[model samples]
Target chain A: MMKIFGKVAAIVAGSALVATAAFAEDRKSYPAPKDHPLSEIISGYEFRTPETRALQDDDFENPAYILLDLGAELWSTADGAAGKSCASCHGDAAESMKGIGASFPKWSKERNKAITVEQQINICREEQMQADTWKWTKDPNMLGMTIFVKNQSRGMPIVLDNSPEMETVRKLGEEVYYTRYGQLDMSCANCHEDYYGNYIRADMLSQGQINGFPTYRLKWNGVGSTHRRFKGCMKNIRANPFKPQGEEFTALEAYMMYRAVGLPIETPSVRN
Target chain B: MRFAALVLSGVFMASVASAEEIKKVEIVDGAVQASLTGKPGDAVAGAKVFKGRRAGNCLACHGNKDMSGEQFHGETGPIMDGVADRYSTEQLRAIVVNSKKVFGDHTLMPAFYEVDRLSRVAKKFEGKTVLSAQQVEDVVAYLLTLKE
Candidate 1:
């Protein structure tokens, strides 16, 4: 009846507003901190073709919105042993989850390790809601929830933990970055650091920043996590990829996030 | 006398098996003095290997001004044009086999033939090299054609 029609109208209007907001937001570039290894840090968006960048600029046109919308629905639907939905505790994600994205791969005192946003989501599910944790990479719900949460912090600059403890993790990440791996004998630095502006065959290499991760890749035709991208790169080099959310990748995430300090969160950003 | 014959036949079998194995070459002062395949390579066939994506894929990293016809030559490594004027045939052979031996472990160029030190290699590519001994020789010959 009239009430049902009104709810549908509100949902349509809300999505329209989000789409318009996405279109209105300008693409802003930030310079790296003075002590950064690279004189200037360039976003992967700059390396992409204008056509690909255009897809990210408009939410209505962005295919990732399909997942984001599903995430919004999941936020309110209660499905755990506790029968508590994310909204039951968080209540209005816009108000509760704002700026949370730019502050992740955070040091967890209880877990005694750095955990990414994806890990945090699982922790909340298991500990808070008594829900089964979703698979790290393959779960669409995990991807959708991650993107929806991170999208809340869009345009906020990444804030890193520069503590002594984080420094040790960052150093390990730096070592991993520099160490040559696999039959190809290529390090992360060999391509990303040394050849950022150059082409490897037809594909242009970028600085390999993770600021725009959980990114929508045209090559994948779907969204993928940063760790998934890392695994793919390791596989491409003919190396055995470390497991996602493992100690090595968490440390690597901490280091990469530090490298990308001051860059705006661009979750669900489109890339080729 | 029978044991001597057995040893000689074993040696013959090893030599025959080695035809498919990665060539053993010595690095002496940044040069390989011996040919890998004990035969000269075809430069024409080497050109295709240099350009082929499944082969050397050299154009992916090193830009060669001489190869203007090839699309999207990369600038990650040193330019390959005029490479003949920079090094001798023996030096080129060593570099082609294993650049790390000559340029040190920090070099971006991969050790195309060396596999012993490689770690965490994919299951399918384990114990395999980026190029064969003959392919390395072919690539070396092709590199020699790039004159100033």
Candidate 2:
């Protein structure tokens, strides 16, 4: 019985160490060579050239810009009984919405749960602006509003509050990252953190950073959101992926943002 | 080695020179065939995909580019240099199509032809493959250019 208790204590202590690590905000910089297998993986990849660098820095006029302008118009034009526009309540997205996207996937102790950016945006529209709840997905007005508004703080550092309530969500994301799923029994850490830079078949393993989000995938044949890309990775693992807009994904985005705190934003990067 | 080359080169010649090369070369499924397509491949475009962000993301795995010991050289597959001497174009095609069919049923090589649906693949790739018919030819063209 005492041995059992000792084992339990060790597990609790191990978990505490991981929890401390989750909040530390800067992992031991990219695993040092000789320590991790991925250290060798990066060396094999043909480093990017000036042309590819240009590809990274090129301007990407959002294909949905027209829709965003329509959203802006909708933001100004009242369509609800309260006669309040979205701009009337939130003011300018750039000025009023600073550090907003970075703080999302936050857990609400009062409500006893975590919330996503998509849900938060709608909550404001429904409660404060007195507007009808925007339908999810196919709603161009909502997609445009969110994208245009989020781009306001394009360079802001992701600053998720390391509150006690967040302990669960961060842990969940970490678990998902390391837990190997699928017929291959390969985990996210195995390919990304562990086998990163290594080849599975032929393609090189990227740093798996979410920094270059909303990237353009030549394979996908168009621009795609980070959530969509993450789902693709999960699918590659042969694991049943969560919906891009689901709560689990929101938590993942939060953890990814936290991990890539200092990395520069590389939106609309052209990927293989 | 000379005998193997003659066989593979002969196989390639018949395939390239005459469309009826299929009858000459033995199609042995469940066995990996590394027949060399004597024709040279395009190193320039191969260089692009090998070094660029577009595709073949070889750099993502193995260190192939010159001038950098930056250490991303992957050990997953044997360093791809002199691949033509090792296997014929048809054999290389099989490896690219599905390395597992030869390397062991369990392989790490992504089925470039099978997954991405590369053009001009076998009946199995009726729907899936990565490279186009021209692109596969180009890769084959480039592979032949790799000689020490």
Candidate 3:
């Protein structure tokens, strides 16, 4: 009887140690007030000229409408091995996908990781439509779809639902934002946080808030997603960017969503 | 535990290591007299470095009177007209090496050579300067030719 009791006690203690190890890997924490010093900065929208602001306000003048038009058509047209349109499964995106973009970069139980809206779209294409995925960084079709999805959530506040599972990734996103890289030796914070309203030559710098993404940038003269913009910034800093829709970008997206918590979703917005 | 030990060893190596292959420059009487090239700087190579996107990209900020035909010449900094009259060749070399030594540290122009003061530098460039010693001299040689 004494021998059996000793064995049971050892097993219980060993399992407890294993449980603690697993818990350490998923340590839950959000950015404290002291952690992110630039938490109170406003969105980049406030720094734009009146002419640019007017362009974003009117849907007809906005050039992103061209991509939106393409996306609307693609939503109903069948193009995959399944020969089924997105409308066939989801039905009238205006009705089903309204405010959906605001919640994305959400935790996906199937993949066991946080997936961005672009990644979710690709997963749906491969699994349900039996089609090829759009290259999240360069493809026009991908940008159109992303712009269209985000346009649906216009005027809605960004909310990630803040699941406990997403906490680890959200922290990692914050880490990526603050960690400095490149030959220029600049981090996202050095420009966006430390020198928010300063001028680097002719261009005025903003605080780098990403509330109005999927914006039509004058530099590109076309629609661009958040990940696409991230790539451009990496290049500008002379750092080789990671692939779009890759784990690093998804983590960055997760952090961006949390940062823009109170701001309205203004996708397909205009920017210089 | 082994991974942690390896990382610690790498950090230790990084701290004690000095720059190699990159020739060092000297500062004398508020000027940099050390030339990357042992001989006179070639004006031709210097011009290429000034305008090329891969390196100096000086024209992006400072307008050059010599390159008047070029499109989108910036008006941010003083035009490079008669720059030779403004500073001596050695002083110009000093400015390129570490501009903060002459201009205040707050200026937008980057220090082309000094390494220790920089932040968020890439891993491969831990203790290295941006322009090689020869490249800096070449840029200096090119700027010297901007006299009217």
State candidate 1's DockQ: 0.32
lDDT of each: 0.81, 0.53, 0.72
B1-24: candidate 3 lDDT, tens digit per residue: 999997787555434332436566
Cand. 3: chain B TM-score: 0.78
Instruction: Give the candidate number with the greatest DockQ.
Output: 1
What ordering of candidates by DockQ runs from best to worst? 1, 3, 2
lDDT by residue (tens digit), candidate 1, B44-96 = 87787788776678898878887789898975666777878777888888888
Ranking by TM-score: 1, 3, 2
Model 1 chain B weakest lDDT span, ten residues long: B10-19
State each model's C-alpha RMSD to the native: 15.4, 13.5, 18.1
Ranking by lDDT: 1, 3, 2
Report how closely model 3 matches the true complex, as a DockQ value. 0.09
- Give a tens-digit lDDT track for model 2, residues B24-89: 223255333443344445667656445443345455544443415444555344455655665666
